[model samples]
Target: MTAKVLNIIKILQPVVIMVVVQISLAGVNILSKLASIDGMSSSILVAYRLLFAAASTVPLAFYMDRTIKPRPMLTWTVIGQAFLCGLLGGSLLLNMYMQSLVLTSVTFVAAMSNLLPVITFILAICFRLEKVLLTKAPGSMKIVGTILGIGGAMLMTFYKGIEIKLWSTNIQLYAHESTSTNKQDRVLGTLIALGSCLSFATWLIVQAKLSKIYPNPYSTTAMMNVMGSLQAILFALFADHDWQHWKLGWDIRLVTVSVSGMIGSGLMVALMAWCNRTKGPLFVSIFSPVCLVVVTLVGTLILGDKLYLGSVLGSIVIVLGLYAVVWAKSKEKESIQCIEEKEQGIV
Candidate 1:
């Protein structure tokens, strides 16, 4: 009986961990939105966040080096890959995302981000890393999901239906501030957010290659953080010449950077790596919609964000599409695993 309980706990552990990760990510979005509203520069925030991430993760990487045997020697190729990963995933992606958050509502950005996996799938196909078995259910589902996701995003972007009045907490954190009310700003923000998603998808592809080369998650992440910090610092310096924007105080800005760095980058990275190893990427990816739901609820209730009919319908569609792709991917993985087992006479 004890062994059975232990087995059950082991099986459920990844699910619980993923739920926590998604909630933590939702917090990051909320804090980032608040900080942006409070006049924090997104570029500067990215720089500081990556700096803190590097500081917190580098020590762990060194510790991992000491404990793990047969450490791969750091090479120029690894350094180059890390640089690209940092550029695409950390500095570029975060800057665009935060900038879009500044220009748009938190819920909008969160909902749009649900397109990441679909975008990644398309990119993988372009890179020839994934095959197109159109006749197969998995392949057909991928294409269908891609269409649904893109269509949902378009609906959210071009169509603003009547506002849905959800119950509000009447507690406005950034009561005085407002997101961009201008139509141009919203359109620009949506485009930038899509760009960030593309950057993130490309990063995943590059990181996959980097993983094959380096294989040390801790050290690789640390290097990426370091590279991202330097790049973001340079970019922020160029973008914002005002020294006042660089200053951090004991306020939302400080809290945002610290929490985003420590939790979003440091702890989440470690937890996700563990989860990925244990339960695969599909398991981790499927939990993304939870973050969107959390953000929508929290934003509407606490931040006084208004929900539009189009946004609601689009988010639902995107989530359905996300599940379709994840299910298809799982089926593909199972098929491959089955083939491997059969070849090995384990089936």
Candidate 2:
């Protein structure tokens, strides 16, 4: 009985971590939206987030990972990891995504985030980290899953069906429905969101590679945050020359940066790196849909964001796709394990 309980706990550990990560991310989304409401620059917000994340993680990394002696040859992988995670994934992705939320609804942005896993899968295949076994069950499932996920994202992007009464409280949508005033903005937001997804996917792939070279998830994530903070600050200074926008006061902006930095950047990315190291990028991305669901409900309840028919339908499709891919991966892992067992004469 004791051994069984331990086994169950081990199995459930990642699931619990993923749940916490998703919840923190969902809250960060809402907080970011609130910060944007007060005319805060997304770039500045991201800069602060990275800075805070670095400040928090650096000490922990140094203290806990003291045994990890860095070698000179590891510089290249560190550079790649820093660029991918800090500049492209952390700063650029967050800036674009937050801006997307400004123009689009939270659910819409969250729905688009489901594209991360599909994109990551494709990148993994490209990098030869994953094989495309078209004749195999795993390959077939992945293909179908990718198609379904892309279809769902497209549906959510292009189709906003008749508003659902309870959640269609967005003033922007009401104003733009007939006038089509923000159509351009919406298109731009969608494009930006796509870029964000792609950037994040690339980051995940690079992170996986980095894990093999560094083998210290906490230190690696801390370095990425530090690098990303510097990159973001440079961009923020150039983009917004007005120093007025950088002010942090006793308000939602402070809360936004604090929570976003501490939870979203610091805790979430570190946990994700650990997950990526253990389970690969696909596993890390599989939990994105969970974040989406939580964000959808939270957006509707707190922000009075619209719950479009298309969003509901697309989210369902995306979730189904996520499950299909997960099932396929599990089967693939089982088959590999069985082969290894037979080879070792343990079966």
TM-scores, in order shown? 0.93, 0.89
Clashes by residue pair, model 1:
none
C-alpha local distance difference test of each model: 0.86, 0.81
Candidate 1: segments with Cα more than 4 A from true spot: 1-6, 176-179, 276-281, 341-347
Segments of candidate 2 deviating more than 4 angstroms: 67-76, 167-181, 342-347
How do the residues 44-152 of candidate 2 rate in per-residue lDDT, one tens digit apiece? 9989988998999999888878775563355875777777778766788778888888888777888888877777777778878788689999989999988888888
For residues 1-347, write the lDDT of model 1, one tens digit per residue.
Answer: 69999999988988899999989989999999988888888999999999998999999889876877788878999999999988997999999999999888889999999998888888878879788689999999999998899999988887888989887667878665354667798889999999998997787667767777787877888888999999999999999999988999999999999999988977776677666555655566678888999999998888978888988999988888988898899899999999999999998
- Local error of candidate 1 at residue 50 (angstroms): 0.6
In model 1, state the lDDT of residue 131.
88
Residue 82's lDDT in candidate 1: 95
